[model samples]
Target: MPSADPSTQPLKSAEELAQSRRRFPGESPQYRAARNALLKEEIELRRHIERVAAQRRALPPGGEIPEDYRFESESGPATLSQMFGEHDTLVTYNWMFGPKRQRSCPMCTSFLSALDGEMADILQRVAFAVIARSPVERLTAFKRERGWRHLRLYSSGGNTFNRDYADEDPDSGDNAGFNVFVRSNGIVRHFWGDEMGPETADPGQDPRGAPDAMPLWTVLDMTPGGRGTDWYPKLEYGAQSKTGT
Candidate 1:
C-alpha cells in the first residue's frame, strides 16, 4: 500500500475504483452486458431501500417529543430537538475520538476522517453531529490534528447524554455507537441504533441509524477492496482492549 498524501485526494471509494477498472477499454459485448446488469441491480436495490425508508416515515405517529432533555454546550444549554438545528431530524455519531490519553477509535476514526471534506449538502438536508462524552475542546483539538474540517461536533461530556443514549454503560463497560433522534408530537424519541444485531469484531458495535458517516464509505467504495478483510480500525492509545491485552 502507498502512503496517502494528506493534502491530495481523489475522493473515490474502493468499489468505485474497482468498477472503473472493471470497465473495458474496447467495446466488448460481454463486458458491456455485465456492466449494465450490475448497474440495473444496484439501481433496483437502492430504490427498494428508499421505498422502505418511505414506509418507515409513513408509519403512524408514536409518542411526543420530550422537551426536557437539556444538554449543556459551550454556548449554553439545548434541547434534544434543538440539536437538529431547524430541521425535523438529527443524527449523532458516538465517537471515541477523544484526548491523546484515549486517542481515537480506529474504526470510528477511519469513518470520521472520511467525513472531514464534504458535509455541506448533508447538513442542508438533515442536521448531523458527532457527540462524545469528552469535552468539546478535546474533540476540536483531535479533529484539527486529524485535519477533518467538514464534520460538526458537540460536547456531551458534562451531561448524562452518554448514559441516556446507551453509548456508555458504566456497569457493562461499553464504549460507543451511532444513534438517530426524531421529533414527533413535540417529543424526541430515539428511533434507531446498533440494536439490529450484527456480529462484529468489537465487543460492542452498532450500525448507526444516522447518515453522517456514510459519505466516506461512498468515497472509499471507489477503491479496489471496497472495504474488505484487510481493513480494520483500532484505538490509538493501544490496539488491545482496556481490560485485556
Candidate 2:
C-alpha cells in the first residue's frame, strides 16, 4: 500500500502515540517517563526518514551512465542494463574485496551476510547485486564459503564500474558503497547513492549513512552497552569471542 500523504492527513502528537502503547510489567514511573520520551523521539525519527525518502523519490532524473559498464557474473559477461533483469530499478552494493586484499573487509562482509538473508524479499520488488573488485571466481568462492545462497555476486575487475560507482582509489583501494540505478525509456541512468563517508561523519561516531542498512548496529543500539567505539566485525570470530553469534 502507498503511504498516506502527510499534507492530506491530520497528524498525531508523538507523545500521545507513545503513551498509547502498553506499558511493560514492573517498570518504574521514572523508567516509563524516559522510555516514553525515547519512543516519541523514535516516532519523530521515523517521520524524518519517510520525509527524506519522499524527497529522494521526487528528485529529478539523475545523470545518464557514461557507458554500459561490463561486469563478470556467474553466467559470464553482463552489462549494467542486463543487471536490472526484469525490474526497472537496480540496487548494487560495492563490496570491498579488491584483488590486493588478503580477505574481504569484515565490515562489508558483515553487511552482505545480513543482505543475503533479505535478497529474496528485496528481489521481488527490485533487482539487486553485489559488485566487487575481485574476480568473479574469487567472489563466488567467498559466497560459497559464506553460504550466501541468494546474493548475485559480480566482478567489476575488467571494467571501470568500481572506479565510477564504488569510489575505487589508486592508493586507498576499494571502498564500500551502495548505488541505485534505473532503466527508463531504454536509457539507463544513475539514481540515489549513499554518499556519506568519513568526511560526513559526525564527531565521535562511525561514518554510517542515515537509515543504516546493517541490522547488526540497529539491534546493538537498543542494548545498554550499545555499539562500542572499538568493537568491529572480524573476518572470523574465534571460539573465545565474548559476543554470541
Candidate 3:
C-alpha cells in the first residue's frame, strides 16, 4: 500500500488532537513544546547546510589536470585530453568495483544511478564519466547487472591511474571514490574528492557535496536521527533512490 503523505491529510479536531498527561512513552509537561522547538532548529540547520553547499560550488574548480592521465571508457581507453573534447574540464567518479569484489558497490551503484539519469543536462557542458579501477569487462558486467543505461562507464585498472589519482588501495580492500578533474594549459589536475571526511567537508560548517550529491545525509535527514550516528552508507539494493538512482 502507498504511504499517506501527512501534508495532504485532513487536520484533526482540536479535542481529538489534545494529548493526555502522557502523550509519549513518558509523562512530561514540556516534552511536546521542547520537540516543537527542536523541529525549528533542524529546519535552520538544513538551511545552513544548503548555504554551505552553495559556497562549495561557487568556490571555483581549481587544480591542473595532466594531459597523459589514462581513463578507460566503454569504447576502450582514452587520455584526459580526449575525454574533455572541446570542453576544458572533466569530472570522473571512481566507482568501487574490482576483480576481487563479488558484488557491485552499493554507494557507488547509487551515485552512478543518479549520474546516469542526469547526464543529459551536464553533457551539454561538463564531461562526466564513471571510472573504475577494475577491468573494463568487469565494470561493464557490473553495470549491466545494475541496469545503468545513460552515463558512460569505464575501467582504469591497468596502470597506477587509481592509485596516482583516486587513492584506491589494492592491499586495503577499501574501494570506490569520486574525484573531479580539470584541464588547463594542457595539464590535467585533481580538484575534489568524496573520501576525506571532517577536514574536507567540515560537516558542521561546510557541506561540500551537500544534500543531493550524497546519499547518507539525503536519506538521514528524512529520519528522526538526522545523521546523528557515525554509520556509513552501505552497499544495498534500492538504497539508490529514484530521484538519484
- Arranged by lDDT with the best first, the candidates are 2, 3, 1
Instruction: Write the residue-wise lDDT of candidate 1 on 30-130 in tens digits.
Output: 87767766776666566567766777667665445344466545456666677877887787777764433356667677777765555777788878877
Ranking according to TM-score, highest score first: 2, 1, 3
lDDT per model vs. reference? 0.63, 0.89, 0.67
- Number of residue pairs clashing in candidate 2, backbone atoms closer than 3 angstroms, sequence gap of 3 or more or interchain: 0
Instruction: Give the higher-TM-score candidate: 2 or 3.
Output: 2
Candidate 3 residue spans exceeding 4 A from truth = 1-43, 54-62, 198-212, 215-217, 225-245
lDDT of 2 by residue, 74-140 (tens): 9999999999999999999999899999888889889999999999999999999899888899999
Per-residue error (Å), model 2, residue 192: 0.7
Model 2 alpha-carbon miss at residue 233, Å: 0.7
TM-score of each: 0.65, 0.93, 0.64
TM-score of candidate 1 against the unseen true structure: 0.65
**Candidate 1: worst 10 consecutive residues by lDDT?**
204-213
Instruction: Tell me model 2's lDDT, rounded to 2 decimals.
Output: 0.89
Candidate 1 segments whose C-alpha is farther than 4 A from its true place: 1-24, 62-67, 98-101, 171-176, 184-186, 197-213, 219-224, 233-245
Clashes of each: 23, 0, 9
